[model samples]
Target: MTPPRDVAVVAYARTDHQGPAEGLSEAETLLPVLHEVLDRAGLAPGEADFTCSGSSDYLAGRPFSFTLTLDAVGAWPPIAESHVEMDGAWALYEAWVKILTGRADTALVYAHGKPSAGDPRDVLTRTLDPYYLAPLWPEPASLAALQARALADAGHTAGPDPAADPLAGPPAVADGAAAVVLAAGDAARRMCGRPAWIRGADHRVEPHALGLRDLTDSPSTRLAAERAGAFRAPVDTAELHVPFAAQDVVLRRALRLDDTVTVNPSGAAAGPLMVAGLIRLGEAAARIHRGASDRALAHATSGPCLQHNLVAVLEGDA
Candidate 1:
């Protein structure tokens, strides 16, 4: 079944993350963004019908880490809230589902990451399969390099730059956070003069075994695009979560993006880990909200070598 209520992104805010952001607490990093998005939509804490977030306790190197971030949102008076271990984009998806279920008319979604706190590559290895991959302790960049090699062997390349090799890019550790506000129908129209309607949204995942899947292609992304109806209408722009240069080739082919679309104008070179993917979705919606495009595609990925993917199609009023 389709969404019960029309949903749109009314406001978005993200930290200016160039690279590593040291000497800042997670709450400090998130507070400004949370306030910015809410203020843009003229909202206050507990104003949104629901609140959700995405982050990794493992990245924080502690258990129940998200609870600490409640300080940033002023979680007193007890508001309905939820969180995901994945990218904030997934939190947004959950919020969208909540709206469709008629459980809420407005929602707040956000995500944050501080990868520079430790060896990011080694930290990421903790998510891999313990039996086969974790024991080997392969760096995240090494796995991307493997994917890049697979693509090259199949005659696919993202750019002529020598850094197109995944290893050349390495795992860029950045620290930051981002947030977005979602409203439904009238609530949306009232909050923002013109909302970025979520025309379609879906996510998919592939087998966990890196060796079992064809690294050159992202079947999960292709399936997500199909499920999200990404091709139903012409796309004017796309914001892709391409941390490493090589993954761009796989995403382009998987989504069938052409030169007609403006890809990642925000440069998306690097950002805080879990936050980057969600920021891509926010950036795409912002483009539509600002009248930069009639329709746009936002993509996010998780797991090693794009094992999981999320696709979103946003459209502005004609």
Candidate 2:
């Protein structure tokens, strides 16, 4: 792919992100961030050429969770829009493709989920293969634990313990929401003085059966990273979606990011949910926007044991 002529993230916003999200409705949880992005870009909702979002009805304990969010955008006179049951990162990808096809020049992308509303583990099982995998009741943590063990057996440690080996235990989960605005060419230049140009973006999926694949390496992520042209440019910072601390090492190695690249400075203890990976991309873009870094890499993951992955490279003007 020649890559889009020019598509950059002009604005980004996120929620306070507490577990369970308490009494806030989905629309309430998302509206503020959506407005924040528009405000940052100095654009109105109606100005967006297209709008798309990602959310799961299963998370809200009701179907059509996104339908209500359309009200928050006040989609009067209707608009070009779409939804995904996946994370906002994928929604961003979908919107990016829309621009590439010459269908829209700008897009608003957002995503939200309340993992606290239900047993996130139980709900996550629905992502597995319905006939074969869902029946086994394999929650995400247990599956991630298995991957952690594989890393340990291969001499990878989650902590400093030479023998303690971290992935031998369970992984952690967090909840949150994220939003970003994308504009093309002249629109991008008009929105922000320092737009974070999306140099490349790609996503890939692995087979559903964990037992049938190699646990040590995430080929899906590796391929996506390569397709995103991460190797073609040097990265000064990398925000990886590593729910399990050790997966950070896995992704860094996969993308060949090393000491020269600063990994997540946001603190390892704070992991956000569905939006976490996507937020990594937004954070990387922010660094470029602020002149804090010249080039950066962002990654997002899905499925049990990191079976699905997406990667994008962001670069600022030289």
Per TM-score, the best of the predicted structures is: 1
- TM-scores of all candidate predictions against the true structure: 0.97, 0.93
Candidate 2 regions with alpha-carbon error over 4 angstroms: 158-175, 268-272
lDDT of 2 at 37: 88
lDDT of 1 by residue, 1-318 (tens): 235579999999999977777788888999999999999999998788899999999988999899989999877788999999988999999999999889999999999898878888889898899999999999878998888888888887555365566767575567899999999999999999779999889999999998799988899999888888898777989899886778888899899988898888877644678888889989988888788888999999898999999999888999
| Clashing residue pairs for model 1 | none
Worst 10 residues of 1 by lDDT: 157-166
Model 2 lDDT tens row, 1-318: 337578999999987664566787778888888889899998888779999888778777887877998888879988989998887889998998899888999999988776767777788888788888899988876776677778878987644243323435433444567889999999899999899999899999888887788887888888998899988868898888876655665777788877798887554523455677668878888888999888988888877877889999899888
Highest lDDT model number: 1
Candidate 1 whole-model C-alpha lDDT, 0 to 1: 0.87
**lDDT computed for candidate 2:** 0.80
Candidate 2 C-alpha error for residue 259, in Å: 0.6
